[model samples]
Target: MSEAGDATVDRAHALDAVLLGGPRTLTLRDLAERSGLDLEQVRLYWRTLGLPHPDADEVAFTCRDGEALERLARLLHEDHLGSRTMISLTRALGHTSDRLALWQVEALVEDMATRRDLDDPAARRAVLDELADLAPVLETQLLHAYRRHLAAIASRYSVEFAAGQDVGGDPAALPLARAVGFADMVSFTRRTAGLGSTDLSDFVQRFETAARDVVTQCGGRVVKTIGDAVLFVADDVRTGAKVALELARVLGGDLDVERERGAGGLAEGARGVTPVRVGVVWGRVLSRFGDVFGPSVNVAARLTDIADPSTVLTDPATARLLVDTPGLLLEPLPARELEGIGTLAPVRVRTA
Candidate 1:
């Protein structure tokens, strides 16, 4: 092997030891035997946690791996967690953390390149060198964020559902009744046409940061942010209205179409972030896979598509729910044929 290849391998092993807490010393079968789990069961757990199963005879497991397996076994026997639920939870963690790790690494790489004035390859090597030192701090922060989110969820459900207020829904419909919506950036493709990596990252990060702040401040939860849109949920129609209107207001502006078309599609808005048109609907939705689903979600996206920039649109049903809401006004727009739902009047929601 070349000297560089050997050096790379040494660095990788050193980093693995730091992150996993030891060298890989145990085979798959050893882990199962030591953790008191069946070989197939261990393989299933490993695969479910977003990893390919190691060969039974491959010495790929570390002490930490065996300990983690033991803890998982204890959850099954001592905590009595359902097998399916345990597997699903483990899968969720694996999936989320996988994306999260990649995102963090990319961010660190950008920082490294900018701060050290290195090229991309050098920046990546710098990140690898620094990551071992940063790992402990990052892990602590992750735990803190996890605990805070769990507490917030618990408190929210306890307060909202503890009174036994009926969350009425059709027997065959999607279960949860909540307000779900999308805030889609106008002229997204055109506006972001030729931005370089740094500029593009800044624009996207700014929009995401701003949108997330507005949603959380309005007592709403952000379901997810698509490439050029944000999906959010609120407990009730009124709160949803507030969230939608606030999002439109905060991210407001019509595309400077002439300037955009003329000047390489430079977006017009606060900090060059394009304006987002918002659509919100109050209806039942199925919650799964950390995302919301149902007809209402579709309707919301359709409304967003038809909405003018920096405006909030809603269906008639949702508009009616907000008629008695204070400090809000609803304006009916001309009837238009929504893609799936024939002709219908969409209402504009704005702060009064």
Candidate 2:
């Protein structure tokens, strides 16, 4: 390859390294070492681009540099931006807008409160103009942040639970009640890995949207989602059962659109769009850091493990609690053994 080609390759690799969690402020020396390019070669590209080279004393760089480097890396990776590129760019723009708005909001709030004595109407108008200018940008940022946060949450529930000696959380002592149970996605490992990040993002968003709608609609709160399963809590078992049923129905029915899109789409290919197994149980549990714990929580998880996709499974006790609620049918599952929890008979809530 020619000198230009080698230089391009070096920069490309450097950017990849940075994007994948390299130091924020990298010096030319560091780039030369990591990129296999001589210091002079790395310097040449910076000089050619008319960007400044901070002194070695100022070697630390910010995440902004890392982002810029990532952009450059992507440019070098492809002669033209493709679909993946567009998706990445869109996600990045959304993230950037969020960070910028957070910083801007702090500044605006500080200024608004501190400048009470600026009596000139023109100055006041300027402040109002600044706020007006920032309104849409800040609103977009908030919406994006909320959307991303929610997507991350729904994506957690699509998995099976495995107990390990791995790091565990410190238990808290507090006023406790038997909160609701939450079940995660059953085929999360296979499904999530097969989907691209953007698609994974979309899948998560759809799940959260549906889940939140049903939970709030039925007067329950979704405490949090953990790795493809959501943790929800209700004041009592009946409410929990109602919340669980609504979640399953919303998720199962919502797959229709993805089903029609095509066979290989996430909705269908993942064994049914929004088709998630649900488990509802009631027992004393502790809540902390947007998560619930205790034996009740574990049983709910295990029950979800036993649930078939598009179905809601509840412990026999939960079924008994809901026995009086009309139109909610329950059928016994064949005697089955579950990990962590022993031989059990769960009632599947049959849909009419």
Candidate 3:
């Protein structure tokens, strides 16, 4: 083997030793036998964790791996969670951790590069040497964040879906009534056309931070971000309107708000980010796999497309729900045909 290949292998083993708490001392069969789980069960569990299944004869399992399998078994029997659910949970962990690991490493590389004025490869090499110390802190933070989020979810579900509070909600809905909305940047491509790496990163970060703050401040949940746009949800129409309007007003606001909130705005040394257009709809949506899906979501997206910059839009039905809402005005706009959604008479919403 080449000397470089040997060095790479050595580095990997060193990382594994630190993270796994010991050297690998067992194979697939050994783990299964030690955990008293069926061979196929262990294989499926490992595979579901976004890990490649090594050869059954390969000694690639460590004590920590074995302990993980044992814990899974205990969770299943003790909690009575079905195997399918456990597998799904395992997949979620694997999928999130895969991206999270790379994201953190890249962030570390950037920090090292910027601090030392080194090139990318040099900074990455330096980072690899320091990662053993950082891994434990990252692992602990991940666990802490996971537990906190899980508790928040439990609390939210208990209140929102209380025993018989609103399960059979509006529109013969999926569960509870929700306000789904989208706020997207205007002329996104033109605004971001020639931004350099650092400038673009700053531009995007500013928008995301502003958008998230807007949603949370107005009692809405940020579902996800799509580069130049944000998807959000609230428990009711009023809250949705508040989120959509605030998002448009905050992130994609007029020149005055932009100067107040984000001085540089859109791109550095470029024209500020133009006002955002928002679309909100009240309806039931399916929440699965960390995303929302339903006709309402689609309608909200369509509405945002047609909304005027720095304004909020919704369908007539959704607008009606907010008619009695205070400090808001809804105006009917000319109906337009949207693909898949057909003709929709949009209502423009503005703060009173």
Candidate 4:
């Protein structure tokens, strides 16, 4: 092997020791025997992590792997967890962590390349070199954040259950009452047309980061961000109204105070951020697989489609709920035909 190849292999071994809590000294068959699991069961568990399985004889499993499998087996035995539920839980962890790890690593690579003026391959090597030192810190932070978020979700559910707001039905059904909304950038394609990759990345990131700050400060949680839009949810209509109105004012440059602050040091090219139109509705929604659905979600999306830039359009139901909300002005728009939703009156919401 070439010297570079030898060096790469050495680095890989070092990483294996650090990350896997030991070298890859066990094959799949060995792991199965050690963990007291069948070969098919071992494969099933491995596949649930969204990872490709190695050959049965390949020495790719570590002691840590065996230990993890043993723990999982114990849980299954103790809790009598069904195969379906086990697979679902494993898949959720696998999917979420897979994307999250990729995003974090890529962000690190970008930071390395930008700060050190290294090329992509070099930056990747640098990241690998630093991973041994960085991995533990990152892992700790990840665990802490996950625990905090889980606690928050559980607390909210407990409160709702206590308040008699629980949706009684199939436990797996999606029938939570929520305030769902979408904010879409105006003329996104036109605004970003012909921009270079770097410029476009900055533009999108700036908008998303800023939008998230506003949403969080206004007591809303960002569900996800599409290419040119953000989906958000709040526990109630009032909080959702605050989120929608604040996003419009901040992103659309409607707030004189914010404008006076001069874009808060955003990139020069992105200083003139694109305006956004918002739509919100309060109704029962089906929360499934990290996303939301149902008629209310559909109505909010349709309202966003018809809304003008820098404005918030809300369904009449939500408007009625917020009729006496302080610091908000609601003007009822004429009944308009929306595809798949028939004619409905949407209220234009703004600062009082």
Off by over 4 Å in 3: 1-9, 161-164, 169-172, 253-274
Predicted model with the maximum TM-score: 1
Model 1 misplaced regions, further than 4 Å:
1-5, 169-173, 254-272
Model 2 error, position 207 (Å): 1.6
Could you give candidate 3's per-residue lDDT for residues 149-244 as a string of tens digits?
899889888987564556553556586568999988988887778888766766776777778777887899898899999899998789899888
Go through the candidates in order and give the clash count of each.
0, 17, 1, 0
Q: TM-score of model 4 relative to the true fold?
A: 0.88
**lDDT of every model, 2 decimals:** 0.85, 0.63, 0.82, 0.85
The local lDDT score (0 to 100) that residue 14 gets in candidate 4 is 91
Q: Which stretches of candidate 2 lie over 4 Å from their true place?
A: 1-174, 253-272
> Model 1: per-residue lDDT, tens digit, 1-352?
9786677678877998899998889999999998888998899889887887768999987999999999999999899989889888888888888889999999999999999999997788788788899999999999999999999988977877876534465468676778998999888888778989997886677678778878988999999998889999998899999999888877764334333533221122332356788999999888887899999999999998899988999999999999999998899999999998778799999888
RMSD of 1: 4.0
Task: Estimate candidate 4's alpha-carbon lDDT, on a 0 to 1 scale.
Answer: 0.85
Better of 2 and 4 by lDDT: 4
Cα RMSD (Å) between model 2 and the true structure?
Answer: 17.7
Report the backbone clash tally of model 3: 1
Regarding lDDT, does 1 or 3 come out ahead?
1
Q: List the residue pairs that clash in candidate 3.
A: 252-276
